[model samples]
Target: MSLANLSRIARAEGDPKVLQTGRSSLPTADRVARSLGWFSIALGLTELFAPGAIARTLGLDGRKGLVRAYGAREIGAGVVSLSTERSLGLWSRVAGDALDLATLAPALGRDNPKRRAAALAFTLVAGVALIDVVAAGSATAVHARAPNRRRNYRDRSGFPQGVAAARGAAAALRAHDDLATARRLPAGSEAKAPAVG
Candidate 1:
């Protein structure tokens, strides 16, 4: 449900539907995703540096679930950031940052298995955090120069270019027909001219 998580997933697992369409994802969308990614990573890092900080920010009890979730998020972000197709480093950073924060959370107080605070977890979190940081930074850089992903026009409402062109051509034909009729008209046949004009 989290944007950071989703971005991570997308980077890891290709969304065939998105790719098949051959349209670029919007820059605004990229920006949002990238921002979320950074936020997640930063949250993790903040918790890591000072577990008390996370508790202070989210109330003391809120820090409990962060440990496991941090691991999940960092791993997720790393996968996403590593993705060759997307390489959404920014989103990865958020995920990694979240890991850093989570690992740091349990360290704030007396360690317990319930906290399940492990050095390995912290290390993994740290590794991913590094990756995410780089990724997130790269994403920011890309965003600055990132080109808008253009989508092909969908003609679902009956206004496809070909259709419109045909309609225009028909109208032109009709106008020509009217001009031919006028040319064919005899001067005395002005009486037969339609009054609609």
Candidate 2:
């Protein structure tokens, strides 16, 4: 019923070759997530500080306010992605991209002189959104498959059993030292150590 026993059972049911030998120390997938997070933060900062430039580039000339609002959303998504698990954060980015494309749809009107620019921007956003979707799915799969092997009190390498293990090891070393010391004495010597009552 304990968590450790459950983990053991799960391991027993699975292929031995599939068992993870040790903890992940910076999984490549996680690193990709973090990189995306930094990218989000950078893009967010650019949008927030230069809404007018972004509006001009995307051919949303008079929609600086809308662009700035989107920037705020970007900043929020960036923070979430960087501070937590990648799945949620990347999904948020995907949602943000959808909103971005929706907002740009009007700029693609036939009468719009900057329609081509808007289309290019939309294409770029769509591509990024695809990446976000893939990354989110990957992150989700990684998270789900990852074992919950938290260092808990019951585990020997964890904190709870620390004192007991240390004490046992120390006692073993002390016994070995005492035997060695006794053997070093003269062959006929009767060493009488004092015992405190």
What are the lDDT scores of the predictions, listed in order? Answer: 0.51, 0.76
Q: Report the C-alpha displacement of residue 193, candidate 2, in angstroms.
A: 28
Stretches of model 2 off by over 4 angstroms after superposition: 1-24, 145-197
User: How close is every model to the real structure, measured as TM-score?
Assistant: 0.30, 0.60
lDDT of 1 at 127: 70
Q: What are the RMSDs of all candidates, in order?
A: 14.8, 13.5
- Give residue 64's lDDT in candidate 1 (0 to 100): 49
Error of 1 at 52 (Å): 25
- The TM-score that candidate 2 achieves is 0.60
For every model in order, what is the number of clashing pairs? 17, 0
